[model samples]
Target: MVFFFLSGKFDQLQHAEPLSAIKTAFNQYFFNISKSDDERINTTRSSILETAGDCIRVLTACFPGLEKIIGSHCTNPTKVGPKETQHRFEYAFRSMVKAIATPSNPVVLFLDDLHWADAYSLHLLTVLATDAYSLHLLTVLATDREIKNFLFIGCLR
Candidate 1:
């Protein structure tokens, strides 16, 4: 079995990456397969963009691959209620995880230092974990044993 490990370490560098874990995972996945011109990958890219064009447009600034996949013509997503916005993010991320992970070659996302992880990263983790069973993906999270930061823990609830 092939296993891909994506590790994102959250440290004191707050200015380094805003959404550390999410940025790390997304960029890592894209970077690894960026050279491929496979038809299936192209199809997945198109499907993701068609299904979540607005969300992808918002994310292009963060993930460069989105811009390459969907081009620069995408406009800002329509302004929606908070719940609808959250749903869009969730759906986009779920599609991304499914695109990369497979039963034969599982992907593992290891996010360390949850205490230092931003609220957005923790929220994204919670969203992915909520749909873990269907994604065929594994997530490993770590933080200081003393549990000084309860923010990430609270996100699970």
Candidate 2:
């Protein structure tokens, strides 16, 4: 399997290259392979929360009102019940749909800590990735674990 690892501090994502890389991937999938089943996944851990926050800020600037919607629920990163996390992610996914539907420009949703994410978060991510083309969305995920479990296992199956 092909795996990409994003390590180090969260602030590093503020640098243009990482964000640009994400944008490039979105463009590639959206424009070049409209009908093809190409899947792009991002994996990160809790260490990059600040970076993920920065990425979301950039996305908000691109798509106004998105920050308010997603920022409200994505506030704290504590461990929570599966149902609660799923609800939060559903809210987040709705925000993403709004942003994508309203704007001419593309939007990227960066999930920065897959390794630490709860089951609901992972389930939402899986749903998003599986339906990315229909939704017109780009998801960037980050994780630290080598062995795939939980969400990763679901992704495999």
Candidate 3:
């Protein structure tokens, strides 16, 4: 989704790397208390949670997992256009989020520093935000007001 817009073409994909300046502070407080699920998922989510080691395990585990499946288009990927990958990324992200969320526990999906996020990421956010009612999601997006305005303007077109 990430691209260098030196020209008017979609250029580079977002590198599958660790997010160093990670974690977003929420304005709305989340109560971590939830009913216990009858079936617990065996996810290593606790390791890369918004803790001191958040970005550490993400590089080796989380981001790679996302990149592997969602970023699977390898045949002249740059020339394939944005629509192709946006749906795939959104589906993968939604599935992952849904799998981790339960009635007892809600999912807090936060994307920070969105000014640097790729087009696909932005597109995914637009999709998720539009369909927020269907999912048990608390989506928090962070960016400068100017960038938000720009995104809004671009989205309208």
Candidate 4:
């Protein structure tokens, strides 16, 4: 899920004169760039790295940090094995719980190319739907095929 504080809080800042306010907003909300040591050059490389880190954090929360397992065990069954998939599902449950418990900020999770997800991922999505209402969270799952499973279909009901 993605959270947006009221737009009004940011709109004025974004449109302020001299663009200093906008720059400040970007710096504070997005990144903690060095203020004293360097010229303020907008670096796309740094921005990309920062965003990737944020994405990793969200994913780690979602699956209780299973990316490491996937990386470590792509070839070694003893290391990652089928249990890694189950751990990912558990992580999703934890993510939902954490988001719901936070209470203040809305959480947004984006699951892209869900068609590539394994059975455990689908199971996690099912569990998420059940606990979804308790959290101020939004999950976006993108897939090429129509998902017709009962767990998903029932969520819309």
Candidate 5:
């Protein structure tokens, strides 16, 4: 099994960026899988790029500059309602992650210090958590010892 350590902790010196953990995770997946000459990795890499690009184009607000990372153009697509677009974004990301994980090679995403994650990041995490039951994927989340907002905890449940 392959493990991808995705940290949600923001640098204290810099401002918290939206989708930083997601971007970092995708970037790691993009580069790491691209290095292999194996046919399965090649196919998985292409799947990740295509699905992630489609979703990122729709979700540029949450993932600024992400299209460039995936080598996609920042073209304006036909606008859909925000809620519909968000659903598409979440579904696409779920598909991308599923493409990487197989019975022989499961993927683990370790997200640390999730309390510092932005609202959009938390929403995406919740979506992934809800879908994890069906995928060969495991998500490990860590937060500070003291959670200031019980509402945030409630929402994640």
Candidate 6:
């Protein structure tokens, strides 16, 4: 049996490599997988914080593998190409999500603050939601009601 434990109570036998600037930059504002331990400890109860922190750790594990794709921007620092950069980020983002998913374990991913999500995040959400329809994954979304023009707020008008 393959078990993917996303619990902080359990020590990770696998060690993750340090994050690159590109990977950290993307996750910083959107999902905050780079949130500090103090931040998590203060925001929630010990139990929840531990589990949440573990979730972040699990997600960020992919950053090490994605270093090449992300670090490419530095290698080509002369050109103006946010489009190509964003596409790579989106691909990396999805790959990170895939690392956390397990068909038998039924993992639930919660995405917060969608009301102000960047283009890459919104695109990734769309991709995940579509793929989730035929998989064991589940997504719980949160959005502020103030965003009257929010794409999912069609009836609020």
Q: Which scores greater on TM-score, model 4 or model 5?
A: 5
lDDT of 4 by residue, 1-157 (tens): 3252211011222222222222232233233222322432233223222333323333333332233222222221234456664564355335433432244545445544343444444555566567645366555665555644333343334
Identify the candidate with maximal lDDT: 1
Candidate 6 Cα lDDT to native:
0.39
Please, what are the lDDT tens digits per residue for candidate 6 over residues 30-145?
24322435543233223222333323322334444322222222231233377765554445445454543446434555544445444434455566666543265565656667
- Which stretch of 10 consecutive residues in model 6 shows the poorest summed lDDT? 6-15
Better of 1 and 2 by TM-score: 1
Question: TM-score for all predictions?
Answer: 0.75, 0.36, 0.43, 0.36, 0.71, 0.41
lDDT per residue as tens, model 3, 86-113: 4544454445445345454566555555
Residues 1-157 of candidate 5 have per-residue lDDT tens digits of: 4555443443323225766766766666555655655775656646556656556556444444333334445565567999887788787677766766666667777766666677777777778778854377777777777756332475467
> What lDDT score belongs to each candidate, Candidate 1 first?
0.71, 0.41, 0.37, 0.38, 0.62, 0.39
Clashing pairs in 4: 1-107, 1-108, 1-109, 2-108, 62-91
Q: List the residue pairs that clash in candidate 2.
A: 42-141, 42-142, 43-141, 43-142, 43-143, 44-142, 44-143
Off by over 4 Å in 1: 15-18, 37-47, 50-54, 73-75, 81-83, 132-134
- Choose the strongest candidate by TM-score: 1
Tell me the spans in candidate 2 whose CA falls farther than 4 Å from its real position: 1-103, 132-135, 146-151
- Spell out the clash pairs found in candidate 6: none
Candidate 4, residue 135: Cα displacement in angstroms equals 2.0
Give the range where candidate 5 is weakest over 10 consecutive residues by summed lDDT: 6-15
Stretches of candidate 4 exceeding 4 Å from the true structure: 1-92, 99-101, 145-157
Q: Which ten residues in a row have the lowest lDDT in candidate 3?
A: 2-11
lDDT of 1 at 103: 79
**Which residue pairs in model 3 clash with each other?**
none
lDDT, candidate 5, residue 11? 34
